[model samples]
Target: MVYPPYLQRSWQRSHNLTNAQQEALEMAVSEAERMTHILQNLLDLTRASHSMMPLQSESLILNDVVADIAEMTKKFEHRVIHLEVAPFPVRVKVDRNQLMQALSHLIGNAVKYSNADELVSLQLTQADSWAVIQVSDKGDGIPLCDQSRIFEPLYRVDPFGARSTGEAGLGLSIVKHLVESMGGKVII
Candidate 1:
């Protein structure tokens, strides 16, 4: 009786994986990571919606935040992020991590929906006593009918697109909650 199935004489163990097999393995890993990200977003949504975590608000410069966001995005997605910020320091009190996540989601959403050649821009400007942050992209926009509901939790404009991107549609909802938590609003 063979104690271990791998010790069978007819069984051959090849140390090398074929190119297709290797690619499949890589794809599987990518999918797994994507799923993990989705789960984390879900947790974030729950926490934000329920106020389980309080805002860790602090004074921050918008220019530095935009610069860091652009640099960080470059590592994850191959896209040009055009940043426009006020020459003067635009300071705001907010949770840095949440703000970064919100901006990153906007930029990532823009990149996902737009053509590779299309432009994506993140702009920060001081308007009156308020600091305005906007993310714009040249992409096929949501239908007017769906635009009003886009920020609702799990509301996807295109389910197929969400499927490919592995987005559970909690991004905009989280953005809304986080921004509101810091006494701000998102205007699209």
Candidate 2:
């Protein structure tokens, strides 16, 4: 979707519009982007569930993958995303796009639940045989009763949760499927 940049260009080119008109356009654009995000999530969930998501596996630099995603997510503008990873290339075999989607979902989750001024951290570290990517936030932790159900399709932690903030509950399910399909483990 041509979201922010289009909205931005419109704003820059619009000099005659009143403040209220400008605000209305901005809000409409925001809503469009939100709907696009939700629709994409639903499609991804369907693909993941049906085992129809294709994998184009390649050797990828882990740091590059995470850094690129972090850069793109900076446009969110609501939460502070702190990405901590070494500049040295850490290599892994996986479908890069799928992995990016999974990581994006994790980062999005952290950003959504955490307060606007709070920090959301994404840390990457390598163990002997596995790469660990941890996403943490300062928000209230998930309830013990809901922890096991969080990755299930259509399951929401709190009804008034992040989905209310513009995401559908399909994200974690898509994340789980994508990671597992790429032969990696997802630990919440």
Candidate 3:
């Protein structure tokens, strides 16, 4: 995340620049933010794989977790994202923070890849002994060939696709690691 002070400094300086200069500065700032996001995701993947991050497992109601994530999604997405869950309670044993991170990765990807008008849905259902949380998007799905490689760190469906978003392809890898660390499996 970009620091507030940095943002403050940037905003304070932006007033002095010409229109073209200000636009350039804004683009630079966005690139820096995307780089920061990539680096953080890399660090998270490393920490998760090496057992450096602690897992604080608890018996959490699946509905509550989904609600919390839905709220966060609404805030981050700044739009009307969709949520569908069973009316009844569904409980699961997992690390709330870790699970939240994983689900956020999934939902965040949904929002990032899809268009503004498209619906990104987070659906929760209980299947036998397991609780399933599915994030579905209307974006063009990943290429068949790329699907298998997506879980690999630094792998992108189309490498040139990063030109627009500056994504370093660490999201899915971190999600996979985080979910597995909590004894839960991630399905693409």
TM-score of each: 0.85, 0.78, 0.90
The CA lDDT at 25 in model 3 is 74
Model 3: lDDT of residue 87 = 86
Worst 10 residues of 1 by lDDT: 1-10
lDDT of 1: 0.83
- Candidate 2 TM-score to native: 0.78
Choose the strongest candidate by lDDT.
3
Candidate 3 off by > 4 Å: 1-11
- Candidate that would win on TM-score: 3
Better of 2 and 3 by TM-score: 3
Tens-place lDDT per residue, model 2, 1-188, is: 66667677876766878898888887878788888887888899889878798889999889888877777777755556799996566789999889988988888888777888898887888888788888899989899999999999878877675545876688999999999998888876
After superposing candidate 2, which stretches have Cα over 4 Å from the reference?
1-36, 86-88
lDDT of 1 by residue, 1-188 (tens): 22234333222332366777667655655666677788888999899889986888899998999889987877778788888889999999888998998887888888988998877888889889999988888898889999899999999999777768788899999888888888888998
